[model samples]
Target: MKNNRFLSILFICLLLAVGVSAQNTVKTSVPDTIIIPVVPDSDTIGIARVRNELAAAKLNEANMRMEIELLKYQADAADSLKQAKQMQRIDSLRALTPGVPVVVTGDTLFYLYAKRGGYTPQQRAQMDADAIEELGKRFNLNPDSVYIESTDIVTDIMYGNKVIVSFTDQDGLWANCSRDQLAAKERQVIVQKLKELKEEHSAWQLGKRILYFILVLAGQYLLFWLTSWLYRKLKVRIQKLKDTKLKPISIQNYQLLDTQKQVNLLIFLANIGRYVVMLLQLLITVPLLFSIFPQTKDLAYTIFSYIWNPVKSIFWGIVEYIPNLFTIIIIYYAVKYLVKGLRYLATEIDSGHLKITGFYPDWALPTFHIFRFLLYAFMIAMIYPYLPGADSDIFKGISVFVGLIVSLGSSTVIGNIMAGLVITYMRPFKLGDRIKLNDTTGNVIEKTALVTRIKTPKNELVTIPNSFIMSSHTVNYSSSARTYGLIIHTEVSIGYDVPWRKVHQLLIDSALATEGVSADPEPFVLETSLQDWYPVYQINAYIKEADKLTQIHSDLLQNIQDKFAEADVEIMSPHYMAMRDGNESTIPKEDIKPQTTGTGSTKPA
Candidate 1:
């Protein structure tokens, strides 16, 4: 009870001191001089003025005494009931004053400041907030040592005499309440909040956090298991589908894809499903786990933003590109139909049904392909700008890189294409035509923009680049074989002793005996050279079938040998040097037998 009385006395003294300080703050600009009339009785006038001054001083003293006495009486009677009444008065004052919020430790406390106070509501609120924050920090460091104290001049919320916050007359006026009263209330709230914070750091709270972390981990594990189960089920379903329903898809009688390809596609789809499920699980799990902890909660939001922002951007980008996509589709189908029309024309021309005066039939397909390529390229060029991100630096850089690569590597390809074009227009040879280029003699089997393939007489397949073929000379045997038979020639050497007329007759007979040789154009023999050892006879035969030239040549040589042998003629074409007895002849002994004729003349067999 004595302690309560002392506290009350201290609080009242603090209030009285605040009032005195507020009174001292008042400024006076008026002069202290007073003029008095001195016409008659100057002493009486001076005395009357002195008495008036005394009376005024006494009245002012009496008013001050009355105020002090009222304060003492209120302080003495400041029990629970009187304090409640005072609080009511404070509440009424607050209703009239402007309220400003003072924020401390994330909590808001209202403060009211009166108009008569020098401080504005905002200034008072700011000051109170700063002081409270400082007090909170100090309370956090040493909560037990912090207390509120009232002195004769001021009330302070202090930590060992170091004032955390002070309340004076100006503060009371600004708050529109008793300074000590407001300070005490603020101190109690701040201390209570600090104690709550300390309690939150206790071992029990730590245990609770640990338990929550364990539960979260268990939940994440369960989610992982569920995700895995779902993926496995999906994969199994896909596998079963692949085994049963997903057979090889075919077009008409042709197999468009085989069973292996179907299985691979199913496996690919299953893998995609598995990975998608895993990714979704990871995304959900990571953010959830991060949100479970205060330290990583912000990071969780950041991570979500990192993925979501790009996904959102891509979704919007695709939505915005819908018109461009439609344009691209229109252009693509337009080019496709145009190419189809060109292909139909090419086919007709290639089949000789469509004739153009200047356009060769062989050029139709290749020209169509070339034109189609150019059209597609033009379509792509037209659509390039409308593509999403086409103007971005990365897209431009990739395009430039691709262009550079093509330009650097296409030199040989360009040459081949050009040579193929030239070869096509030149009409050197067509497919299945027997032709000879340099030393290679063959029938053309295939021709493309890059290379020409030939099947040689030896059944060897030879592929020659179009550029190489363009640079070499070519001889086409089948070109004129149909209209004018191609000539097949073979050379034979014979001893001068054998008559040239007889040799020519023998060569012509051999050529005529060859099956592929044309009978209409009679075979002829030319005495190409008169050498020292023998004469060179070239037998020229017309053959309607150029492809059978090799077989016919072989047959002709056999026929020549058989004819020469039958006539008992020795074929010593290359040079014959032999030591012969006087009776020995070049003919076979059996053929050298003598026979008697009708006139009794002897003849060699």
Candidate 2:
């Protein structure tokens, strides 16, 4: 503006200087160039010279006007250059001037360089930002409400009653633009930002979001319904499969999991899948719903991050666990195959196909089981580190607690297992072997790590703890019956009147006549005890079958009675001796004497 004023004053000075130069030129000019006309003799020559002089004067006047215009053009050029330099200087000052950015939705629209006396540029920028934010928050507001007002010093870019920002001449100077131009530009920017904010949160946009949300919910419900329906269908199919495809999972003769347990496991897995899918749908839908509204847009992202963080962590945990999982799988399979091979070897040995010296076939399976248990324990120890959350205190704590419980509660059980192992290698008895343990004599039927079951001769089942068996004596009669023959012996009392040789011969003959008696190893009789009135005659006979000991003994006693009755050799009893020698009543007629008394009922006599 000062440059403009200077240019105007220079134009006025040029006009005055031109007027003075013209007057001076008029004063300095020769009076009609009389000296030039003197050389002209003729009137025609004088008239031609005068016309030439007038042409010269017009030419000189045109040249003087050209000089004046040239001088003015130079002054204008100087002023333009000076103004450009001042503009450059202002631009440099503006570059050095600190400004606060007016940010909207994380984007900086412009800088606020103007500051009041009480407020810094930052504070001014905050006011502007707050105004724009308040305006944008109105979903029903229109961008056309934004307008500008020009005052003597400042231009205000306003929306309704809110001033978004204002521009002054100083501000324009800083921006290197006019006040109105800067204000208009700022207004345009603010209005455009407000329009974007309004559009984003408008009813139409919200409706679209609602539609999307509905679609998502519909899809989610559909998935849930599908999952449930599929689960029901699978349940029905599984129920049907219970009678068809599903069976108890068994290893050899041992059932690991029942058919019903398998069905329940499958159903549980299906339910878990359903919950996971529904939860995933909810995660997606809730975030999308939140994001539809501009006010909750950041909240939407926050919620998404919250929900996705765990999912992402779990996914990454699984991904990272893959290598460990593979390692565990490999270790499991290696141990499994090794155990399988050992089991095969044990089976071979147990079936008597394979034999080792001093190692009985009965020892094979139990030893294999011990080795398998150790291998499984070692496998657990090896694989524990690779398990997810293995490093967690809770996992370690649980493991320690379980181990502590087992160690504390399983003393007797462990003793039994150890005794069972010892009993197995000791080859004390096997299945179907007639054995006597403590006061229980029976055939061994089932043997376990903790207890052994025996079926008695009277069909009574007796379970004996292996630990107790370890401390007690066990007689395995059948152990040598197949080779040597089990001796079945019974004692009979004979009167002293009978000769020892006769008593011995009679008992031996009775044992020989009995069924199930082995004659090759002849029966023998021994005088076990000699009483005052009778002698104990013990007869021993060998039988190939030890399990039939009860039946053989019954038959031997019956045969002894018959042989003694026929031979007239009395098989004496104390009662018979008392009746015969003490002169007891021989008839019922002598012992029964009926005596009737008054008011007494006569009982059978």
Query: Among these predicted structures, which one has the highest lDDT?
Result: 2
Question: Model 1 Cα displacement at 564 (Å)?
Answer: 2.5
**Global lDDT of each model?**
0.78, 0.83
Candidate 2 residues 335-357, lDDT tens each? 99999999999999989998888
- Clash pairs, model 2 backbone: none
> Which stretches of candidate 1 lie above 4 Å from their native place?
1-215, 229-276, 292-296, 577-605
lDDT string, candidate 1, 495-515, tens digits: 877898998899898889889
Quote the lDDT for 476 in model 2.
Answer: 92
| TM-score of model 2 vs. true structure | 0.60
Best model number under TM-score: 1
